[model samples]
Target chain A: MTDFLYNYLHVYLFVALFMLFCGIVGVVYRRTLIGMLVSLELIMNGAGLNLVALNRFVSPENAYGTAFTLIIMGIAAAEAAVALGIIILIFRKYRHIEGGDLREMRD
Target chain B: MNFAEIIFLFIIAVTMGGAATAVLAGSVVYAIMGLVVTMFGVAALYVYLNSPFVALMQILIYVGAVTVLIAFAVMLVGPLYRRPKEWTTAGKFGAALGVALVSLLLFVRFVTETFPRAGAPSFEMTTKDIGRLFFDDLVLPFELISLLIVVAILGAIMLALFARGNK
Candidate 1:
C-alpha cells in the first residue's frame, strides 16, 4: 500500500479511474440534464488526469502531453457552455429540463 | 510515509469522497458543490505531477469558470433539489456497476505493474518546456480549439433565438 501510494503514476491513475467510474454511474442515474452535464465534466476531468499522469511518468521533459491535457480542459469548458445554452433553450421550450421531458422532436 | 505522501493520500481521499457526493447526492446543487471540491483535489494532484501551471489552470478553468457556469444553469432551470428518484431502479444501477467493475478489473491488472522510472519521480517541467507549449507545441491547435469554442457558443445563442422565435 505504501509503495503503491508513493508512486505518482499509480496514485493519480487510481483517482482518475475512480472519477471515471463515478461519472459513468452519475450520467446513467441522473434524470436531469444539468446533472448529466455535471457527470460529463467529471468524465472529462478523469481523462485529463489520466493524460497528465502518463505524461509525468513516461516523459516529463516533454510538454506535448501536458498541452493536450490543457486542450482537453478547454474542450470541457466549451462543452459545458454549449450544454448550458441547450439546457436554457430546453427549459424555455418545455418549462422543464428533465431527461424524460425531451421525448419528441416537435409538439 | 513522509509529509508529501500524506498530503497526496489526503487529496486522493478528498477527490474520491467529492466524486461520490457529486454522483450519488440527491440534488443537483450539492453535486455542483462536490464538483468544486473534486476539481480542487484534481488541481492538487497536478501539483504532484510537478506542473504548478497546469494545476493553477485546472483551478482557474474548472473550479472558477465551469463550476460557476453549471451553478448558473442549475439556477436557471426550473427545479433545484430534485432527488434522484429515477435512480432507485435496480436494473439501471446494476448496469452501471457492472460496467465500472469490468473496466476496473481490466485496468488494475496493468496498472499494478509499475514502470521503472528514474530516481525520486520528480520530473520538473521547466519554464522553457512550458514556453514551448505556447510557442512551438500548441499554437495552431490552440487557435483551432478556441475557434471551435466560439462556434459552439454562437450555436448556443442561435439555438436560444430559435427557441424564442418558435414561441
Candidate 2:
C-alpha cells in the first residue's frame, strides 16, 4: 500500500497546478511591480515543476524535460534581473512602482 | 499510507501551503520567506522523484540565489512596510478566475491519466547521465543560456544607470 501510494504521478501534478493558481492570483492582486515579479517567478516554477513531473512519470528516457526546466530557470533569473532594474527605474521616475500608478504611457 | 508515504504527503503539503502563503501574503518580505519554505518542499519533491542533483540545484538556485536577490531588491528600492495598496485593477478579477478554472481542469486531467500502468517504469538516469546528456546533446542551449544571462545583466545595469541620470 505504501509503494502504491508513493509511486503515483498525481501528487506532483496537483502541486504544480496549485502553484500555477497561486501565481495567477498573485499576478492579479498584487499592486507593486516587485510583487508582480515575484508572482511571475512562481508561475515559471510551476511550469518547471510540470515539465519535471511529466518527464519523471510519462517519458522516463527523455532528458528533454529536465533540460528545458534548467533553461527555464536561466531565463527566470535573467527575467528577474531585468524586471528589478525596471522596477527601480520606474520608482525613481514616477516616485511610485505601483501597477495602478503606471496609467500614463504617453507623455 | 506507510511512514514514508505519509512523510511524502506531509512534504507535499508543506510545499503547496508555503507557495500559497507566499503568493497570498500582503507583505513582500513574508512572501520571500514563504518562497524559501516552498523551495524546501520542492527540493523534497525532487528527491521523491529520484533526482537528487536537481533537488540540490533547486534549493541552491531558487531558494538561495534567487530569493536572496529578490529580498535585496525589495529592501533597496521601495518602502518595506508601508503596506502597498491592496486593490487590484478592474479586469484582474476575471483573469484570475479564468486561470484558476483552467488550472483545475488541468489538474483533473493529470490525475485521471496518472494511473495507466501498474508500476514505476524501470529506467535509471543518474546525475552522470544527466551531465553527459546536458553537455553532449544540449550544448547549444547551455551556451546560449549563458549568453542570455550576460545580456540581461548588462541591460539591467544600463537601465539603472539611465534611471539615475534622469534624477
Candidate 3:
C-alpha cells in the first residue's frame, strides 16, 4: 500500500489524536464505569499508535518503538483486567456501575 | 486508488467509526462491540507501519483478550439499560471540545516541526528480531514487564475474590 497517507506519518498522528480526543470526551461524558474503561483503552491504544508511528517514521533503524508498543499492550491488558474487576466489585456493593452514584466513599 | 490503498482507507474508516461508536454509544455492551472493531482496525494499521509482529500481537492481546475482559465486566456488572442522561452539561462538553482542539493544534505543530522526514528502510523488523532483542538488549525491560503482569494478574484475582465475598 504505497498510498500517500499510508506511507506518511500525518494520517497516523491524526488518528492517534482522534483516539485521544474520543478517550477524553468519553471519560468526561460516560456515565458508567465500564464505559470509562473502554475509553481508557482507546487512550492507551492512542499512545501505542504514537509510538509505532514515530518508530516507523523518525527512526526506522530501531525497534524500541515496537518494543514499547508491546509493553504498552501488556500494561493495557493489565489495566483493563484490574479496572473491570474493580467495576464488578463496585457493582456488587452498590448494585449498579454508574459513576454518578459513587460520590461518597464508604465501607 | 489501488487495492491496497483502498483497503488502508477502509481500515482508517473502520477505526474512526468504531471509536465514535464506542464513545457515543448508549450502552456499554454496544460500546464493547465498537471497541473490538477499533482494536482490529488498529492492528491492521500496525501492518502498514511495517511491524507485522506487533500487528499480530495487537490482534492477539487487544481484540482477543482485552475486549473479552471488558465484555465479561459488561455482562457481570449490572442490567444494561440505555443511559437516560449524561452528567455533562453544555458548558462541560464545550470545555472538553475546547481542550481537544487546543491540544490537537499544539501536538500537531510539535510533531510537524520536530520530526524529520524518513525514507524507506533497508530492513523490516520481524518477530525473530523482536525475540532476539527480548533476550539481548531489551532483556531488562522485558523481565520488568513480566513482573508487572504477574502483579496485575494476582491483583485482579484478589479483587475478583473480594467481589465474591469469599475471602
Q: Give me the runs in candidate 2 sitting further than 4 Å from their true place.
A: A104-107, B85-95, B110-118
Q: lDDT per residue, candidate 1, A1-107, as tens digits?
A: 32545464666788998999899898887878888898899999998999888888777667777888888888888888888988898888777777865887463
Ranking by TM-score: 3, 1, 2
Residue A96 alpha-carbon offset, candidate 1, angstroms = 2.1
Q: What value does the interface RMSD of model 1 take? A: 2.3
Q: What's the lDDT of the predicted structure labeled candidate 1?
A: 0.82
- Candidate 2: TM-score of chain A is 0.91
Better structure of 2 and 3 per TM-score: 3
Ranking by DockQ: 3, 1, 2
List the candidates' TM-scores in order.
Answer: 0.91, 0.90, 0.92
Query: Residue-wise lDDT of candidate 2 within A44-100, one digit each (tens)?
Result: 887888787778878898777877887888888888888888777777777777887
Supply DockQ values for each candidate: 0.61, 0.60, 0.64
Residue B149 C-alpha lDDT in model 2: 96
Scored against the true structure, residue A56 in model 3 reaches a CA lDDT of 82
Which candidate has the highest DockQ of all? Answer: 3
